[model samples]
Target: MTIAYWCVLASCLLPLLAVGYAKFLSSDSDPKNYDNNNPRDYLAKLKGDGQRALWAEKNTLEAMPLFFAAVIIAHNTGADQATLDALAISFIGFRLLYIYLYISDKATLRSLSWFAGLACCVAMFIISA
Candidate 1:
């Protein structure tokens, strides 16, 4: 499989990382605080960085479909493989940075990272055209 395809896989899994951090590692390690029986409820109660991580997971999930389609469209349209891979990697990088910025409460940087990731997605479509 191409690097772009691997990136698609990565994008699909990226939200899991955010959710894992939000649910398990963000803070409040007391096991009783976690409501496995009602995970959504537990997540809904998260605050500060935990809440930010959950939001990051949600936003990442929201972005995945378009990025997936963009990569596939670029690949099938005979866009340059190397360039496609680069953009895919860039998207991942920007998203990782976005997650970090979100968790760190750096709203401005997070927004910039989000825009950069979106730009990468748009570039994929442009390359396909």
Candidate 2:
């Protein structure tokens, strides 16, 4: 399979993995406790779900265009297999690291990971261009 294809697959799979991890992290309390009527309870649940969703949304917003741009540039400029693979893997790996750091609430580490992923995306586009 092509590098772009793999990147797309990874993009789709990452959010699902994040959701699963979030569910795993949730407390083993009664479902009634998740009710939307109570402001505090609802806010708590929203906070937890929002973190994961925000991370996924940010990743998706940043990654998709880069992935597509890489693919298009690769096709246009005849980029080599290794270069394409490296770009794809870098994007995926950095995104995973970003998710981990975000979930762990490591402020500095999360910021670093986010910056690294953004840099990787820019670098990929620059290289492809």
Candidate 3:
């Protein structure tokens, strides 16, 4: 598969990292541990970085369909392979930065990264046209 295609796969899995942080790394290990049976309840109780991580996971998931469509449409419609790959990489990089900034509670930078990532998706669609 192309790098852009591989990036799609990577994008699919990226939420795991945030959810992992929210579920495992952020919580106390005792009675307040990750609740498999009531995961949402457990997650809802998180604050600060944990809550931000959960939000990051949710936001990433929400962004995926547009990204998936952009990459696939760009590929099928013959966007320049190298350019598509670069944009795909940029998207991933921006998303990674977004997640980190979110978890770190850097609101302004996180919004910038989010917008940058969205721009990459839009670029993919435009390149295909």
Once fitted onto the true fold, the runs of candidate 2 whose alpha carbons sit more than 4 angstroms away are 27-44, 48-58
Best by lDDT: 1
Error (Å) of candidate 1 at residue 40 is: 0.6
Q: What is the lDDT of residue 105 in candidate 3?
A: 92
- For 1-129, candidate 3 gives per-residue lDDT tens digits of 999999999999899999888888874423455678988888888888889999999999999999999999998999999999999999999999999999999999999999999999999999999
In terms of TM-score, how similar is model 1 to the real structure? 0.95
Error of 3 at 78 (Å): 0.8
Candidate 3 whole-model C-alpha lDDT, 0 to 1: 0.92
| C-alpha positional error of residue 124 in candidate 1 after TM-score superposition, expressed in Å | 0.5
lDDT of each: 0.93, 0.64, 0.92
- Candidate 1 vs candidate 2: the lDDT winner is 1
Q: Which of candidates 2 and 3 reaches a greater TM-score?
A: 3
RMSD to the native, candidate 3? Answer: 1.6
Per-residue CA lDDT of candidate 2, range 1-129, in tens? 777667868876777666545444433323445554663454345455445545655565666676667666765776666776776778788778877776666768877877776776666567666
**For each candidate, what TM-score against the reference?**
0.95, 0.70, 0.94
